[model samples]
Target: MMSALVLYVTDDCSLCDQALELMAAAGAPDFQSVFIDDVPALQTTYGWRVPVVHDGHRGRELDWPFDVAALRAFLQPG
Candidate 1:
């Protein structure tokens, strides 16, 4: 099994919903959704950039506005 990707998101964020949809469409690997609103550090780091997809092991990130193709590329091993 592939490692789980971390999806940083906030409540009431339409973009986050869209990002989830895109990830599903792209057949992305397992992932965990992290709500950043409660964590000060996470809020500061990803407040303006919600819907961020991160590969923990690889330390890579894919921000919003990504399509299926870009998502596929981002999920690739470095």
Candidate 2:
């Protein structure tokens, strides 16, 4: 299975929660969801860009709102 990382960058963002839920439903066994508000550097870099999903292994990122297919592709190995 491929490893995936998701950065849900948002402070009190509903969209971020939605993204997490989506990932859970998509068979993402293990994924990291980092909130932008929690990290200073992430806040500075992606202040308003919430619900961003990052594939650490692949070094790829996908910002929401993303469809199921797009998300699956991002999570999978190329």
Candidate 3:
């Protein structure tokens, strides 16, 4: 099953692309990719913050400019 981790992103975004690479490099666990462009509420909530990492289970969010270490910490069980 996919974890509660969600990566909010939009199309044609370079930073989102970079975030994907960071996710891979960090060996992040299975996560959901939410296309904010496709969802109005999501678009409104994440229009300019397309690269946010959200932990649904914990109701936490990690915004952009996160390194591998931060990613790891975010993924840790609370």
Model 2, stretches more than 4 Å misplaced?
1-4
Scored by lDDT, model 3 comes in at 0.89
Judge candidate 2 against the unseen true structure and give its global Cα lDDT, from 0 to 1: 0.74
Highest TM-score scorer: 1
Model 2 earns a TM-score of 0.80
Number of clashing residue pairs, candidate 2: 0
The TM-score values for the models, in the order shown, are 0.91, 0.80, 0.90
lDDT of 2 at 46: 70
| TM-score order of candidates, top first | 1, 3, 2
Residues 41-62 of candidate 3: C-alpha lDDT, one tens digit per residue: 8888999887999998899999
lDDT of 1 by residue, 1-78 (tens): 545699999999999999999989988888988999999999999999888999888888888878899999888777
Best-fitting candidate, scored by lDDT: 1
Error (Å) of candidate 2 at residue 20 is 1.1
After superposition, which runs of candidate 3 have C-alpha atoms over 4 Å from their true positions? none
Whole-model Cα lDDT per candidate?
0.90, 0.74, 0.89
Ordered from best to worst lDDT, the candidate numbers read: 1, 3, 2
Per-candidate RMSD, Å: 2.0, 2.8, 1.2
